[model samples]
Target: MGNCNSCPSKGNCNSDSGCSGLVPKYGKIKHIIGIISGKGGVGKSTVTGILAVQLRKLGYTVGVLDGDITGPSIPRFFGINDKRSDISQVGDGGEVKFAPVETSMGIKVMSLNLLTEEEEAPVIWRGPVITGVLKQMYSDTEWGELDYLLIDMPPGTGDIALTIMQEVPLEGMVIVSTPQEMVSMIVKKVVIMAKKMNVNIVGVVENMSYVICGKCGEKIRVFSKKTAEEQAEYLGLPLLAEMPINLDLVESMENGNVEDYVSKSEEYEVLLDNFKNKIGI
Candidate 1:
């Protein structure tokens, strides 16, 4: 490395000649992909967590917005429980700018949990109120620039999803499902909802399709087969992946750390690479 004794940056600013040192500019960010599943209890939030970590490890500035108001789980999945305090700083023209509480990865984030003191409390707002809050989150929070904003949507494509589709501008959506018929059928509801909203289909991911026996070295497909695969073919899109049932992953997640698996997993490499290529990243 060349001598940097007089380098203007402490590694946070630009080095443009004739210009004061400033935080480096990465340029305009383009896409926002919502991670959605048809119904609940299919490990959708875990999948989102894995994707977010993988994307960041690959050097993309990513953020997550937990749109699943009824039961926000993203914060817990990532093991982040920091209360989001409003940050106000006087800017040019005596104007005040507010920033949301960001996660440790430097990903700006906000959720209903941030405002509430307890996670078990229920959010029973009407459809319009819910929509208003989401709209405010988008326009108010200074997300700055992000390569991908993976939304962990609520279980079903209900009133909340409709309101979000009508309000927030999104690039596309990724569907998550399980191998069971009941689960796959429920998630199909979101697919229909996405179609009605005219959102681009990123792809589908099957979570917990099979489990590998610890001692036997045998793979058991407890859920059905050909569900996600068949759906992808019928929809004329690609199948993102089917994450195997790894007990280690479950332990890591429970300990508030899923990156323990996603970071070094080969499956993640293939899935993320495919996502980048398909989305023109």
Candidate 2:
């Protein structure tokens, strides 16, 4: 047998085996894709939920591991609240594991908000503790078998984001951004960070790329800012999808039924198809 300690791949080998903090037994995940952004309010979680639901529609088992410990909205967006992870003994000698809560569409979900008493309660945790929780969500939670696990990552290149990039065996990422150029700078940093971590980027998805006029139905660029196409070109990746601002989606999110929104949106149908082709899913 070749000595893994002396091999030159530097622990980045393409193998099915899991590492120390991540074990295949917890999930045996086929792909781990993160939905990330450069800053907040770009609808990262919205894209995450839409992708998970859409992927499920394509007949693949899916799950979502909310990596945003302090700012967890994946649960709320899916109308999941007041639910805690079920604990069970995995084997002998008192080894316990937390099971991810299943959504209405049977998508496994785990998040800090689900564990907390109140959804509005502040996490108030340090960086390392938060990162530890993110790790435990994968290691300690029983995600079972899934074709794809979409991680709803928090905004910015912070400690938790770095932890996910470094610790999790990310297959690729879907970078979400708005039309603003200021936000593009942060998105560029995220791209650089992903490359540094040796993670493959599936493509970019621009949310709120435009707003449709209620009276005339004319598509209008909200801020007239630089779009994701230019940034994706700069990063040398494809622009997979661009979501326009729609009132129906806004109402769905307000009512905490994002899955229904994704299913009902005709635009999402085409977007999902484009995303699948780009990611080869």
Candidate 3:
């Protein structure tokens, strides 16, 4: 109510805000969190997939909204690349609704790739069209009852990111970054944008922070001397997890078996705990 800077209604809203009405009408989504980054190639989608898988592992109903329209990869990661969503008519007005595709682990996923004829097809639409499609995907999808719906945001503070921040009723955001100083610097821009938009940041996850030696079981910080702890301290956010590069996990992702990796990885168990604590769930 202070300035209404972050409100979807902007300058037109009063104390009796109706911002919650902006959310999708068909689902009882308890939490809608965005996984975001300022720079690309920081494994933002990977973090999103991991968080969804971990939340699902705890018997919570979850959904993943692939907001990266141009480079949608959530469906592929969940092994639903070949699957297509079904549409149905609802209500007296006959509103069209989309049914999200379910993974083997029962996590719901909605992505532009799922609706496209080819998985590799490029989304070459303009900014307005892309944002419109994203908004429709969120509001028109029948997500059912979900404990968590993670929005895998596109890289940078572009139109899609700004649109989602303003329109979506996000509970919070999870920032993903890397060990590189340049990457951390770029990620801070996203933090600033989120703060200005009044979006709550849950924490930061450092992906590909280090690698373990296969021969002797030693940690190798090959990417940079700068650590996630330093980056988090600089950004004044909690360091959720310093995720190591595991060839096995990478292979599983490549083969569309992320759920399998989440099921068997002890490291993911720790990450799940950290995420739970940070999100206070």
Tens-digit lDDT string for candidate 1 (1-281): 21122222224324334323111121233456778887788887888888888888878887777888778887777766657546454556654333555655666566777767787789898877886666555444566677767778887877767765664456677888887777767777788788888877788888887888889978788877565577566545579887787778778767856665678778667678777777777
Off by over 4 Å in 1: 1-29, 87-98, 225-228, 234-236
Off by over 4 Å in 3: 1-17, 90-94
Worst 10 residues of 1 by lDDT: 19-28
Would you list the rank order by lDDT, best first? 3, 2, 1
**Candidate structures ordered by TM-score, highest first:** 3, 2, 1
**Candidate 2 at residue 179, lDDT?**
76
| Reference-based TM-score of each model | 0.80, 0.88, 0.91
The lDDT for every candidate, in the order shown, is 0.69, 0.80, 0.86
lDDT of model 1 at residue 121?
A: 86
Kindly list the per-residue Cα lDDT of model 2 for residues 154-194, writing each as its tens digit.
99889988887876667788999877878777888998898
> lDDT of candidate 1 vs native?
0.69
